[model samples]
Target: MHGRLAKSFKMFVLVALCMSLTLGVLSGLAMAQEKKVIRCFVQAYTPRERMEADRWDPPQYYWKLEQEYEKLHPDIDIQFLKPIVGEYEAWFVTQMTGGTAPEILWRQLGAAKADYVKDWYLDFTPYLEKPNPYVEGNDYWKDIFIPAVSESAVAPDGKTYVLGVDIVGVGIYYNKNMFAEAGVTIPSTWKEFMDIQEKIESAGCTPTSFPLGGAMSNPGSWSVRLLQDMMLDSKMMEIKTGVKGAKGVVKRTREQGGSISWMELVRAIKLGIYSAKDPQWQEQWKLLKEWSRYWQKGFLAAEDTDAYRLYITGKAGMLYDGSWQVKPTEVDSLREFDFGLFNFPKVTEESSPYATGIECPSIGGAGCAAGNFCVPLVVKERGLADETIDWLMFVTAPQNLIPLCNDLGSFAPALKVTEGVDPRLLPFIKQLERGSERIQPDLSILTPQYYQQHYRILQQYIGGRLTMDEATDKLQREMEKGADTLIDQHPEWGLKK
Candidate 1:
C-alpha cells in the first residue's frame, strides 16, 4: 500500500510541472503580442511635390520599415502620415503645434531644432543612460554613428534628440557613352570639367543639363559639389569634419585658401556662363546669352521633365544631376545608359577637390521629413520611448544603408559597410573617401528669401547688373546683417562672421 501511494504522488508532481511549462509558453506569446506602436509624420518628397500626385506615385521606401517594425512587435504599428501637396509646412504647423502630436515624429534639425530643442523636442538621456536588457550594450548611442549624426541629435545639456538616418546632397552625374564619345579621360580639374562640356556641345550634343527656376537659375547645387575645392584649399571642412553643427560660412580647399576671395569667385562666376535658351539645360541661365546661342534649335523650350527624358533617351550627351535623376532599375533608359559621376568641378584648381555649393542641413523649418527626422520632447515622456530609440538605431544600422542607397539611386554616405555599393557610384565615392568631405543641401532646405536675395545678386553680377566689386560688397553687407540676427537667435550655432 505504501509503494503504490508513493508512485501516485510522483505522477501528480510530473503533471503539475508540465502544466506550468505550457502556461508559461502561452504567457510569453501574449507578452510578445502586447508590443507598443508609434505614429510618425513626414513632409512630402520634392518628386512627389513636383508631380503632386499627377503622374508620380509615392515611393515604398518606408514600406519595408513598416513591415519590419510590425514583425518585431505584433502590437506596435508605425502609421506614416504625409502632408498635403505644397501644404506640408502649413499642415504640420497646424496639427503639431495644435497639440495633435505624433508619438514618434521627425523633421529636419535645422534652425527649427534650435527653436524646438528648448520645448518642442524630447531628451533621450534617460533611455540612453542604460542599455535595454533584451538588447546588447547601446553601442550606437556611444560610438557607432558618424560624429555629424550625433552632433545634430545631441543637445548641449547632454540629451540625444534625433539621429540623422542619411545624408542628402547633389553631385554631378555624367554619361559613360558621352565620356567615351568625347575621348576625354575623366577630368580632374575644373577646367577639364568645362572642356568636357565644350566638347560635348561641339559634338552636337548638350554638355550637361540641370533644373533652374524663378527669374533665374541658382547654382547652389553647383557650389556645394565644388565646396571641397574650398575644403582642400581651406581648413574649414577639416575643422568641422565629424563634428556636427560647426559654424561654417565658407570652407575652402588648400588651393582655394584665400586664393580666390569671395569677391574673386564672384568675378569668375560670370566666366562660367550657361545658356538660358538651351531649355535643353534645365538650369540654363540668361546671363550667358552667348552660351544659349550655341544650343541646337527647340532646346530652349523644353521643360525639366522633357530634358530628363531627352538625356535618358540618349539624345543628350551628358546630364548634370544628382542621385534623384537615376530612377529605379525598372526605368528602361536609366538601366540602359551606364552613367558616370564626378564631383562637380572646382572653381579653381582641378587637382583641388570640389566643395558643394549648398549649405546648412538640419534646419527645423520647411516641414518635409523625408531624408530627415526630428523627435519631439513629448515622445520622451512616454513609457515606450525605449522602443522609439530602438527604431532609430535599427533604421541607421549599416545593414540598412545599402538598401536605402539603392532605393534613392544616388551616392551613399561614407559609412562603414560590409560589401560594395553600386558600381556607377564607386568612382565618386572613392574620391570622397580619399579627399575632404562636406555635406551640401538641396533647395528644399535653403531659406527661400535668403536664396532669392543671393540669386538676384548673382544674376545681377552675371547679367552685368552688379560689377564684381558691387557684388562682393552686397554679399558682405548681407552676410553681416544676417549674421547678427542668426548669432543673436542661436549663439550655439557659432554663426559669427
Candidate 2:
C-alpha cells in the first residue's frame, strides 16, 4: 500500500509540470496577438540579411534600435519589411494607390512630387512642434535636428511631410596615392583645380571619372549647376524677391544657411532672370565642355559603376560622388590605395568673369537627406499612424541616431548628435555646416519635362555633336516653355491669369 501511494504522487507531479508548460506557451501566443504591428520600409537601412547580401561584417544598427524599441514598448511590434525591388518611384505609387503601403516608408517630400498635394502623405507639422518624449530636454521635436535640415523639412505648402534623419553632401573622392604621385594638393580655386587635374593626367592617370551621359548624368550636370549658381550669386536677392531693389523682403533664414521660396522661383522665371538665353547660362555649359577634357574616355557613355570601377582601380585620380560612397569604397577588399575627399573647388574670376567669387554652397539642403521617413495617410485608417510616428521619434532621437549614423558611415546625421559618429564622416559634417542654400534651384527637378530635353541638349553639345549656338537656342526654347507650363500649373503663384 505505501509503494502504490508513492507512485501515484510522482504521476501527479509530472502532470502538473506539463500543464504549466502548456499554459506558458498559450500566454506568449496571447501577448503576440495583443501587440500592435507597425510595418516599416527602411530602404537602404533594411537589415543586410533581409536584402540577402549578409556577408558584410558589422550588422546594420537599425535592427538594434528596432529591438530596443520593442523592449521598451511591449505592447507594440515593429515589423521591418524587405527592401523594395525595381523602380522605387513606380513601386511606391502602386503601393499607395493600392492602399497597401507600409505604415512607415523611406521617402522624402520630393519623392513622388505630387503625393503631398494629393494628400497621400501625412502632414507632420503638428507633430514636429510637439516635444519628443524620448529626447531629454526636448522643447520641440524639430529643435533636436540640425537647424538647417530641420527648417528645410517644411514643404512649399508650409507643412512638414517627411522626417529627414540624415543629411547628404557631395564631394570629390580622390585616390590619395595617385594625388601623391602627381605631386598635387587639394585645389581651392577653379583654376588651381583645373591645373591639378592637368598634372594628374600628365602623370598618366585619368583626372576624373565624370559620367555625363547614359544613365549617369548627375555628376556632369551637377558640375554645371554648381558653376551656374556661383555665376548667379550676385543676382540672388533680386531673383529671390523678384525685384532688383526690393527692401523689407524678409530674407528667409536657414539657421546659418538660406533658401529661396518656391513662389520666388516662379517669380524669377516669370521675370526672365532664370532664362537660358542669358550669357551666364551659356558660359556654364562652356565651362562644362572645357572640364570634359580631363574626364575619363567615353565619359558620355560611362555608367556610375564604371566611374567607380575606374577610381577604385587607381586608373582615375578622382571621382565626383556623394557621401554614400564612403561605405562600400572604404570597405572594398580589392582596393589597394587609400582615398580622401575634398569639396568641389570654388569657381573664381580666373575661371570666368561671370563668377561672383561667392563660392557655390553645398548642394545638400533639408530636402536632401537619407533615412527620410514618411507616413501614408492610409495608416490612420489602419490604426498604426501613432505607433509609426512614435517609432520614428524613438529612432531619430540622438541616442539612437548616433549608432545608426556611425554604422551606415554614409550620410551625416541630421540631428546635432555628433558624439561617437564615424570619423570618416567628420569632413562631410564640417562642409555641411558651411553650406548655404543654392541660389539657383535645380531646373530638372523643378521642371521635369524640360530636364530630359536639357540632358539631351547637354550631351549633344558636350560630345561635339552640337555647336554652342545650336545648343543654347534649343535650351532657351525648352526653358521658356517649361517655365510657362510650371506657372500655369500653379495658380497660387500668381504668375498666370
- For all candidates in order, the CA lDDT equals 0.47, 0.76
**Candidate 2, residue 239: lDDT:** 73
lDDT of 1 by residue, 1-497 (tens): 99999999999999999999999999988886665667666442222233543333345555686677578767776676665556555765665576567765555544344454446666655654544333345443434433344444544445555544444434455678777887776765555666776888787777655433344342333443243333323333223342323344443221111222222222222222111111211121222332333333454334456556666767666555445554432254344667755555444433223323332121111111244556665665666666676776555555554565555554443344426555544443343222222322323212345445655665455445666567656755554444345446555554443
TM per prediction:
0.64, 0.89
Considering every candidate listed, which one attains the maximal lDDT?
A: 2
- Which whole-number lDDT from 0 to 100 does residue 100 have in model 2? 93
Which stretches of model 2 miss by more than 4 angstroms? Answer: 1-30, 50-59, 112-114, 243-258, 437-445
Each candidate structure's count of clashing pairs: 46, 0
Ten contiguous residues minimizing lDDT sum, candidate 1: 360-369
Clash pairs for candidate 2: none
Model 2 TM-score on a 0 to 1 scale: 0.89
